[model samples]
Target: NNRFTERNRCPADIEKNLEYITLIWLDENIDDSNESVQMQRLLYKMNNYVLLYTDPHLCIDYIKTIVDENIILIICASLHELVLPIIHSLNTVRAVFLTCNDHLKLTSVCSEYPKVAAICTDQQQLIKSIHGTIQSMSNQTMSFTLFDSNKQNSTRDSASILWYRLLIDILKTLPHTDQSKNEMLDKCAEFYRFNEAELQKIDMFRTSYTASKAIEWYTSECFLYKLLNKALRTEDIDLLYVFRFYIIDLYSQLELEHHKQFRINNNWDKLIVAISWASNFKR
Candidate 1:
């Protein structure tokens, strides 16, 4: 499923904590009374929301003044490309939910910015995506609060603490090289050497995924062979084991594609060699 958000409903606390949400309705005139009723229903569900009906020609002038933080930007599809420059300028926009059906246009925009959280096919999906994104942001805020509270009593050295902070930031941003991963592991070793108890401090941050899982994601995406070679050269058996499953999964996917092509042309020789190459990692 290409689900933009979780299937689970938002918790009550997050709903109560919502500060403000902004909706930019681009249509200057709505002739249908039923559509107005639907708009009212959506507005009623949102918290402390400000609905701005903008003339398509004048949206640029009005959007310049909106500077609120933690904002969920809901805009009409017609204004998708027009508002992108404004969206780029506004760092306060946490996520974007669009009332758009132009799949190609949506794809192009999302490719440019992963922050375009969801493009709603209909009004119902738009509301759900906004609620989900808000809840996710709220949960992240709560986690940051708890993470800060837990570190209040920490007595680790400044160097170790700095590395720990840097490592967490790197993990959040991801796509770092194997060399960077090795550097992060070295920092962790330094942290452990200074005070073994400090290692437990990362438990809260790892709630999303263990370091192994993060490494698995990285190796699967790019540099799989290079990383495997680096792990062997560095005698990083732990890193090698962490990556084994990802390597195996990649080989399986590749082998399937190769087999399908071979079957079409009845090329038994190439298929045998490819299968043999994939199986060597099993040892």
Candidate 2:
């Protein structure tokens, strides 16, 4: 009865997600007790979509269905040897969290697979591992390419990096309305749904946020930080469209500061401007 509860849900579609990371846990006794439900509650807090399964086969089958989203797979230590080999090569599986009482002993087994992000002996450690893993992935280097008019032969990989830059440049030129901000807020409110803390942060954003303070709100690491980073990491066009209002704001503020720093310098020829796009942009 404690599963999912009535709050902290993104959308009902297991196949689709608004954010990037989808937390899937597989273990026969995953929800066998109230303690299990409490642990899941924490996972759901870290991510809106949390799926718990008892059957490993069902878990693997469902993971195969995921597209354009990163999966954080959680399993008991007992299942490590049996399940790790099967899902190790699946590109969708971003990070694996192994839960067991004797994680120290399982290190050698898990080290064989590069996707195994962490081995946690307890629920608290599991939560910490998941959060840290996602944060690290979100901070991964973005794709970048120097577009040279002199060089006519750019590979598809380089084209993608240039696309990110062009996309941002085009967005900065377009017009964003207040409705964009409201739409983004509405989506955030819906995704967070009944979560009190996130809703409170959203309310604060609505009441106090401004264009000039874009960097501040982003650095606050509130709901905006989480949502924005997830969409950019996955390159979810729909969510990014909703966030365009703030993206332009942030870029404009950055450019303003960038120019301000240049105006004080006499060496204009020596000046250089650098732009960095979003990540797990590493793809």
Candidate 3:
């Protein structure tokens, strides 16, 4: 099943995390109320993958399944004691927002764990805090592995880096086709099922996209940007393969722009710079 199950219900574990942020909401009162529905809609605006769960244990299990993305967990005050202890130690669980009142109890808990954000009793305050925290985390450095050739234990890391470089090269050479573009848009629509704003963006892309505007779409920071950024950052081979349609266009457009940067009066401008032979680029 897709991430957004019927009525934002708890979904089965996703095999991997393919995005920068995931907001997991664990509360017993996730009923069909205006407040709950509005809160969830706001959260979706910040991050597309928002999971709703009533059972603390099931939520924790889902959290454990995520690897590449940072999780922003929102849980009811009642479940904090049982859930916080388990999630606090997990590196993926980056920020935790505890809701409901009892400031005295939460202040003590917050002191013990700095990762736990401020206690948000009011719904508006909770959303504001979550929005700020998500913005902060988005700016924070993403997870990546460094490969050092000098280290003997770097075999795996180094190989993975090489593999990624090779994969990019192969994708750049693949023939772009209408079929590939359709596949990409279909997958995006599936993943962003309940996200109306992103769906509209996707629809626009389907009707108006062209290879010349590949970089524009990539940098728009819309659904395409979020999905592409995640796939590249996580080195998700399967997802990257599906994104081949846009990747080739991105490469060709970059090449076109690079060529244009040197043109003056119908003649290519000469560029001069000093760098050692060991530098990655060669003239």
Evaluated against the true structure, the overall lDDT of model 3 is 0.71
Question: Model 3 off-target regions past 4 Å?
Answer: 1-17, 141-161, 258-283
The alpha-carbon lDDT assigned to residue 34 of candidate 2 equals 78
User: What would the per-residue lDDT of candidate 2 be over residues 4-104, giving only the tens digit for each residue?
Assistant: 44222223334356666788887777544678778877877777767877777767777777776788888888777788888889998998988888766
lDDT of 2: 0.69
Q: lDDT per model, in order?
A: 0.46, 0.69, 0.71
Worst 10 residues of 1 by lDDT: 1-10
- Itemize residue pairs with steric clashes in candidate 1: none
For model 3, state the Cα shift of residue 119 in Å.
Answer: 0.2
Query: What would the C-alpha RMSD of candidate 3 be, to one decimal place?
Result: 6.9
TM-score per prediction, in order, is: 0.40, 0.72, 0.80
Which candidate, 1 or 2, would have the higher TM-score against the true structure?
2
**Candidate 2 error regions (>4 Å):** 1-12, 101-108, 117-121, 141-176, 263-283
Shift in Å, residue 124, candidate 3: 0.8
Candidate with top lDDT is 3
- Per-residue error for 258 in candidate 1, Å, reads 64
